[model samples]
Target chain A: MDIPTYADVEAAHARIALHIHRTPILTSSFINDLTGAELFFKCENFQKAGAFKARGASNAVFGLDEKMAKVGVATHSSGNHALSLSYAAGKRGIPVTVVMPRTAPEPKKAAVRGYGGHIVECEPSTSSREAVFAEVVAETGAEFVHPYNDPRVIAGQGTCSKEMVEDLGELDAVVAPIGGGGMVSGCCLTLSTIAPKTKIYAAEPKNADDAYRSFKAGRIIADDAPQTVADGLKVPLKELTWHFVSKHVEDIFTATEEEIVAAMRLIWERMKIVMEPSSAVPLAAILKNKELFAGKRVGVIVTGGNVDLGKLPWAQS
Target chain B: MDIPTYADVEAAHARIALHIHRTPILTSSFINDLTGAELFFKCENFQKAGAFKARGASNAVFGLDEKMAKVGVATHSSGNHALSLSYAAGKRGIPVTVVMPRTAPEPKKAAVRGYGGHIVECEPSTSSREAVFAEVVAETGAEFVHPYNDPRVIAGQGTCSKEMVEDLGELDAVVAPIGGGGMVSGCCLTLSTIAPKTKIYAAEPKNADDAYRSFKAGRIIADDAPQTVADGLKVPLKELTWHFVSKHVEDIFTATEEEIVAAMRLIWERMKIVMEPSSAVPLAAILKNKELFAGKRVGVIVTGGNVDLGKLPWAQS
Candidate 1:
């Protein structure tokens, strides 16, 4: 497998430049005071389709050559990736099909359809989803745009940290939530080359700490299905992402579900930005283990902002 | 009583430029498509202290003469103004005394105290608040900075639209929620002189539609007490605001409480930015009266993002 490099990230940035929003980096003095470190938040929550996935999705959809572009792309995700891929394909004016679980939120389904994505629903179980997705890909011959593991998608996510450095200059550390490890690996890929001194940290929920365990064990530790309030971080790390994590990641921190929710609430209250529970893990990790980041300038990649307002974890679950 | 002029706004902008955030304007294609008009949201929710009141509060605090500044400022707001004034006072390193109702949200009181402001509690009644506020002023000799009715405050608020027009070039109409009308008056102060072609519109909650009634009756109509999900807009328009609303405002539109909550939820979910119910009034108004804004490039002032996350208007009210 060809690993995505700085050059691939640069190419991805150029390709997705027009398709995705160059989201702004935001700062909260209150959060800075709370964390004892000045933090620059790369606000991917404000990206097109309301997440950083848009960057990777746009790169994948737009990078396809004329012949492949006609066939379009396909993905199986019940979350931001599905909406992001649909948004990218919609922008490119191409056909994109998303295989989603039948038990997925109705609003998520409507959002995908709203972006002109054709939905193929399967049983809520992972095996059923994988089986149905394979059938769809076999019939359509659409390029499979994996959410995080693919070189192209990882390269696209790298552009986020690239912009962060370009906009905010040097940083002592970069922290992001790790689920499938796409965003975290992207950070590692960029910082390992450009800002070699800047440490890369991956934050995960304690309930789904496969990445943490993998990093400690120096190997890939996949989980069957770990449940957490951070619904986005359930996926295990893939080979491509694990390569970057094992090589470049300084440490992996795990936050409790309550800690994640509390951090999310504090951010919404003080920073006044709406972000999902997954995005709060980094802050939770920092707050829980503050001594490491004290008085340093840190770059925090706020992953996404798609949450069910009617069923906020703190409120309902 | 002096009416704040365009020059006063310019002076206020210069004074508060260093202290306040030149918050970015956010656009949502989803909202744009839904409303049938292009909208530029002047994101004052991102302002220092999390509201446009920061502009005016900073102006008042920083504009103070050194001798007068020693005594600091006082106000009787249990809302964003209280926090904003405290934030400005904290910046200036001066004393800020806020007369808040004892029945106010503990989190709000904590926020006020967090900014190093002295809180003087009064009975949960306007009469008691005014009486206690007067006592605090009399005892401390602190300058009273009225939330919206003052020239300095209005001038400070004007900078929002000033920056909006500077950033977005031209807007066909500008819509803002009106309570005491600091933000709307500010828009009037700036756009009426500079961007004269931009028609000014104010949105009010039907539950507290004194401004709407005042606009229709061509007089200042003060309400004793009114309730709405938009807590910031329950206050009636004062004389300084009425001057602007009567002279420059083209029309005032009202949205029901349910509409206000729905609009707030939509903005939080789709825009992925947290703004208070008061800020949603403009969008609710636009959605309710869509044709007026259809095809027009309009500016919507998102006033604040300070809300009780635990008791969201949609989730509870």
Candidate 2:
């Protein structure tokens, strides 16, 4: 497979512009005071299908050749990507099947179905996920759109950073949560080409620190069943995403579950925006490692807002 | 005392240009489909002090001459106005004293203090509120800024509609939640002038339906201690606000507590914005009275967002 380039990202943006929202950027004086860094939040939480994954999903679904599109599309995702692809398929009036772990948030499952996507359940393990997804593809003859590893999806995700830089001019740095490193890799591809002076930082939950481990060790590491409140970020990285992460990322910073929840709550209370725990990881990392970001103008990708309102991370169990 | 006019609203907007945020407008296709109306939400929750009250408060504080500014400003309120006045006063480096109900949310109280305002607790009664406020103004020699009844404050609040109409062209009608009727009166004051054909609707909690009763009976009826999850709507309409509510408002609608909570949750879940229960009242009313708004372009003022996230109205007791 060929590694996706900035040109691919530009093509993805042009193809998906009509389908995706040019989501707004929000800033907070309170958050700026907390870390002494001027931070701009790219509110992808308001994105169609409630995530930045909609960018990649739309790119994959819309970019399909006439013959391949006739077969429809399928993917195995913990949550966001599943619903995003479902949204794109629903828009195009094509069939989509998502293999999801049964433990995925009920909200995401309901949203996927709301967008007319079928769900195939799997155990929260890579073996079960791959097996179930393959079974669905074989049964339906669906064109498989890999959640993160595919060059097309990487190119699609890169469009987020492209919009961010174009809207914000140049930022001193950019931070985004790293789950399978799809968003980070996209940021890397765009920032390296367009804003070459900008530093890219990847934030991860300490409980699911596979990306941090991979960056520090210079090799890919997989976690079988990492547990954290940030359910969307428990998956391991793939070859396509790791390509950009290893080459262009400045560093990977990790925040504990407590820090993640606190940062999420702060944004909810102070900035008055609803976002999932995964989206808060970048702010959590910045707050924890203040020296690295202090006095700098940074961009934080607010990844998504699809979470059960009843199951907020800080709610007393 | 004289009523505030469009000229005053325009002047207030100029005076407050430096002290307040020209808050953004948001819309949800899901909500529009559900209600069969094109809903434009003016998000005053993202206002400088997390409420539309900031406009009035900023105008009042900033409009004061240097001699009156030396003594600062004071108000008696439940929550949003208290914090809003504090926020405006803080910006001017002036003293602000607030006579607030002891039962007000802790988050609002914390914000008031954070903005360098002194809070004096009053009982949840009009008599106590007036008495406590009088004592504070006398003791501190502060200029009294009525939460809603003042012409300056009404003109300031009217600016919200001026901005909304400027950005949205002409809506078929405008809906705003009625607490003490500041925001609704502002809407009436502006829509009646610039967009004369656009009707105005006021929403109230059924539990605190003084505004509805006032509209029905053709006279203002005071509520002693109405109870509702939307704490901000507990106050009764005053003479100045009653003028607009009686003459210009098309109708007043009351919503049940359950409906208000549902609408609040729907916006938070779908629109991905944090807004107070009071803000949801207008949408709740719209959902109930669909015939009045169906197939029309409607504007709903999202009042404020300064709620304790720990105590969301939808959360279990």
Candidate 3:
């Protein structure tokens, strides 16, 4: 197995630079005062497809050879990844097929289609999704791009922190939400080499705290059917993501579903940016353990901004 | 009465440089494609106190002489202005008394109080508000900062467009929502001098189209109590704001209430920015008259982001 490195992050950034938005770093004095921490938010939420997944997806779609690129790419995602992969492949004028569960939100499905991606619906279970995805890959002869477990995807995710470190200079710590741990793994691969002093913290929803438990038990903890308002963080960490999680993460913090909702609303109100519940997990973690981050210069990754406006978490009846 | 000039905007920017946020100019290719116009959004919603009122309020608060500065400031606004004045005063370590209607939302009242502004509740009617405000001003000797009509406030608001013109270069047209028309007045003041070729457009809700009527009538038109989802644009244009509007504005466009709500949601969903209904009026206007703005580099000022999330216009039953 070839592990991704800091060099791969550099290569990924160069390859996908034109395809993705070098999203801005936003700071709010009011939010800083409330948290008692100087926070720099790397807004990947404003990326090409409204998530950091665009970076990884762009790398995979754009880095392919002429022969492989013609055949295009395929993936299974119920969230930002499907939209992002489609967005990336569409930019390259390639046809990307997404295997989405039938139960996925209509808006998410529409988004993938809107980006010129082909959607093949599967059953709601992981086993069914994979089984359907495998058939799609075999039929289309498409290059399989696993959502967060692949080296190419992890390298692409690393570009976010690369820009963060470059923009903000030194930071006391960097934090991001951990679901499949793609973003965290990317951060680890980049930060461990270049910004070795900066601590890496992975945030998770308490209702779906498999990553936190896994980190504590020093073993992978798989959750068959975890549920949370931070819907993006329901997946368990895979081996590739676990390798980086175990090696580089300083800590894993968990926030309650209520706390996540509050933080999401706070960011929307104060920062005036649309971010999903998953993006707020880090802020929830910071607010939950203020003592740990007090007076520290922290880099917070705003992972994505793709939320169904009609179904805002706070407004959910 | 002295009219505000480009020089006043420059001086105001320098005076409030440390106080106000030089908010970023965001571009959305998605929104651009939808509207068929190249739009540069000057995000004043991300401004201090979550509105462009911060610029004018900060200028008024900071430009005061030592004696007047000690006397503090007073305003009668149940909206962004009250919170902005309070924020400006708080930054200057001076007292501010806001005369708001007793029926004003709890969150708006709490925001004013949070910024250390003393609040004096008045009846909801305009007459009662003015009557109560007069008494407070007489008692405290606090210099009054009118939300839009004052020369100082107009000059402060001009700085927003000044930054926009500087950031994006010469725009074919600049459009902003008009209620009291402080922002549009500011744009008129600054652009009339610096980029005289740039056309200025004022957007108004058809339900509260006082500015649109006034522009056509060749005189000021006051709507005593017009209602619209864009709460910020309820007040009619006053003398000072009307001066610039009559002299420099190319056209005043009106959008339906439904159009405003749709545009607001589109910005939130596509641009990933939390903008108020008033901010969307300009976009709604652009979208309504797509032929007029098509293929042109247009500057749209997103006036504010202060909205009750629970009562989002689209989510209302």
For residues A1-317, could you state the per-residue lDDT of candidate 1 as single tens digits?
77988999999999999888889889998889988999999999999888899988998988899899899899988588999999999998999999987867677788899999999998765567779999999999999999988999999999999998898887999999999899998898888888899999999999999999999998889886577889788888889999999999999999999999999998998888999899999999999889999999999999998888888887864
Model 2: iRMSD?
A: 0.6
**Candidate 3 wrongly placed segments (more than 4 Å):** none
List-wise, what DockQ does each model earn? Answer: 0.89, 0.89, 0.89
Displacement of residue A195 (Cα, Å) in model 1 is 2.0
C-alpha positional error of residue A148 in candidate 1 after TM-score superposition, expressed in Å: 1.6
Predicted candidate 2 versus true structure: per-residue lDDT over B24-129, tens digit per residue:
9999989999999999999999998899999999999998999999998899999999999999999999999999999999999999999999999999888889
Q: What fraction of the genuine interface contacts, i.e. the true contacts, does candidate 1 reproduce? A: 0.97
lDDT of 3 by residue, B1-317 (tens): 87877889999999999988999999999899988999999999999888999999999999899999998999998589999999999999998999998876676788889999999999766678789999999999999999999999999999999998888888999999999899999999999999999999999999999899999999998876677898888887889989999999999999999999999998998889998999999999999999999999999999988888877898874
Give me the runs in candidate 1 sitting further than 4 Å from their true place. Answer: A123-126, B123-125
In candidate 3 chain A, where is summed lDDT lowest over 10 consecutive residues? A100-109
Q: Pick the candidate with the highest TM-score.
A: 2
lDDT of 3 at A277: 93
Per-residue lDDT of A197 in model 1: 90
> Each prediction's Cα lDDT score?
0.90, 0.93, 0.91
TM-score for chain A as predicted in candidate 2: 0.99
